[model samples]
Target: MKAIVFGSTGFIGSHTVEQLILKGHKVTAVVRSHSNVAFLQSLDVRIVEIDYSDTASIKEEIEGHEVVYNCIGSVGLRSKIDLENAVEIDLTKKLVRAASLSGANRFIQLSSIVVYDFHSSEPLDESYCIKPQYLIQQLLLKREEVVRKIGEETGITTIILRPASAIGRRDYMSFFSRLFQQHMNDQFPLLKNGETKVSLVDTRDVGRAMEWLGNYPFPKGSMNLFLLKGFDTTWKSLKEEIDYERGIEVTICDLSNIVEDPVSYTLNTFRTHRVWNDEKIRKLGFTTKYSQRESVKDAVQDFRDRERI
Candidate 1:
């Protein structure tokens, strides 16, 4: 299979490219000229710089690629919502349109579980009602809408994957990175007595799923969505793993009452027990291979290596 991935330098995108190559597929990474390609250069994939503003140019780049994987996203906690939308929604619009025009067989979009009502009393699935409250969640919802709507009109097979909080070696900027840094400084805090269960999926597992999806046969013009979750574990357990990795006893702080960054922390952490049902994807012969503990250990080591701790 020949595939092209946008935002190939990002946390998830890099892993996707790696897994695809390991599976013996031809992969191409589409990135901007100003973006860093150092890590991408290490992989056995072709790298191309394209101007996303021109849909025709994007189409030209996308042509001859059987599958187009969109791992582009803004995971920054404090990014302005408009900027997030521009990257998440506007840029995605161009990419999907180009894929449709380029005769691509499938378009896989990377979405988040936050698009669902995390306040649900039961586990979330594809059927759960979407009630995105905050700005980031709202933009994600819009992005999904754009993909599905355009996919239907263009008669292209589109798949939307809502992955849980992704963590691993390449997690440069995300909640887990911040959490690790805070833990290293003994400033990490917990909500609900550090027993809040977080839905986590390894970035490697996410990449493997994308590789599997690339081979799965789907009817033309069909749209499918799935939730991907590796395992669910509590903050206390995760913190202990990190504590063991760093060889330091972390002083657990409780911020349940304060809720410092309510918007980001709420959804990222103990906001109404954000669990997901990924049976749909699992039934399709794709399941998580890495556990939360393994991912946490890898992340801790990666951070230490990068920071020279």
Candidate 2:
């Protein structure tokens, strides 16, 4: 197998690249000029640095690859809403166009589970209609639509993977990472008494899911969407698990006292139950290696080993 991975320096992308290499696939990783490639330097893969703003360059880089995996997206607790919109909307459109033009056999897109409406108590599936609330959520919804539309028109098989909050090693700046850090510093906030449920999946599992879908046979001119979630738990349970694993009782602050920021916007997401049904992916023989408890323990230990906490 030959694959090209964009956003290879990111948390999820890095894991996917590692899994692909372990599966004995030839891999090419695309990154930006200033991206830190220290972790990827020792991997058995080719690394290409290119300006993503150049569509022609992206098209050229994507050519001759059997599979193109797009893991590019905005990260952080806070960002310029406008900048994020452009990256999720414009850059994604460009990548889809370039991949279709490059004649890739399959295009796998990394989407978010947050695209589903949060008002429902039942777990969401791939068939759920998108009702995004935040600016970032809206951007992701648009990205999914654009990819499907382009794939349908170009006769390329497109697979969309919407994974829950992915947590694992090397995820230094994700929401979960920041939450762990804040807990260590005694500054973590609890929203609505931490009653809302959140679905989570380990980055390794997410990577494996992508690898599985990459090799799965998709009928010509078809687009498939799968929701990937390992375990579902309340915010309070997640915090308790981390505390028990670390042997420390971290203080949970009042959400009302926290200042309004990007982090606050993210915390607002947890005020509602956001769980997804993984039966769709499970039917395809996808199994998660780490449960929610195991993932939390591993992530906290990784943070400690890296001296991040």
Candidate 3:
């Protein structure tokens, strides 16, 4: 299949492009002119630069592609200018509209599991009701709704994948990656006992899942949602993995006493034990290749290689 991956320079996007190429699919990586292409340059892909703000140009570039992977979005914990919602929703709308006009066979959207209620005691599944607690969560939910409506009306086979916190090679902005970097600098903080379980997925597995979906036989105009989780582990376990990998026992700073508005919310988010029922995709024969331990080790190695440490 001929595929075009937007935002192909970023973490998930780069991995997705790699998986697509490895699966014998011809891939065209689309990115902004100023975006870094160091990783994409290493792969056997046709890279195209375009302004995402221009729908005509997007449609022109997307014309010859059978599949359009919309991996464009902001990832991180920041509320400045409502950046998450603005970039995610606005760019998604443009991409969908262009893909519809360009006659693309399928549109794959990369969404986050954060759309589900973060504090839920039960495991989150695709059928679980979306009750986002904060500003970014609210916007992500809104983005999914927009995709559903646009897909139904435009008759595009659209798939929305809500992946857990992604970490591995090319990971920079994820929670675990930041935590690992902080740990390396001896400034990592632990919430309470650091026993809260966090659901995480490997970016490579996510890319594999996207490639599988691209070839799946779904009816045109159908909208499907799937949850992708690689493995479940606790904060303490992750920290221990880092310690063992780096060969050091670092001092843990207690954040259990901090109780305020934004600070408390951010800390409590990591503190909350979140589990995902990602069985839907797995039952369909989608298997994850990376374990929690492997993911942590790879992420650590990637960081070291990048920093030349």
Each prediction's TM-score versus the true structure: 0.94, 0.91, 0.95
True-structure lDDT of candidate 3: 0.84
Of 2 and 3, the candidate ranking higher by TM-score: 3
Cα lDDT of model 1 by residue, 223-273, tens digit:
999899889887777788888888888887777666444556354456467
* Model 3 misplaced regions, further than 4 Å: 82-85, 262-265
Tell me the alpha-carbon RMSD of every candidate: 2.1, 2.6, 1.8
Residue 192 alpha-carbon offset, candidate 2, angstroms: 4.3
Instruction: Indicate which candidate wins on lDDT.
Output: 3
For the record, the alpha-carbon RMSD of candidate 2 to the native fold, in angstroms, is 2.6
What would the per-residue lDDT of candidate 2 be over residues 1-309, giving only the tens digit for each residue?
899999899999999999999899999999999899988898999999999778899999999998999988654435656734466778877888888899888899998775666558677888877676676677677788888998988988899999998889889777788788788886666788888888899998999998999999889769999999888898888888888888988888777566665454465666768888989889888898889888988888888788853
Mark the 10 consecutive residues where model 3 has the least summed lDDT.
76-85
Candidate 3 lDDT over residue span 1-309, tens digit each: 999999898888999999999999999999898988989999999999998777889899999899999887654556563744487788888888788889899899998876766557667788887666677777878788878888988999899998988888987777777788789778667786788887888888999999999999888789999999999888788788889889898888788877777543467666777889889988888999999888878888898898984
Q: Any runs in candidate 1 off by more than 4 Å, and if so which?
A: 83-87, 259-268
The per-model lDDT (C-alpha) reads 0.84, 0.84, 0.84
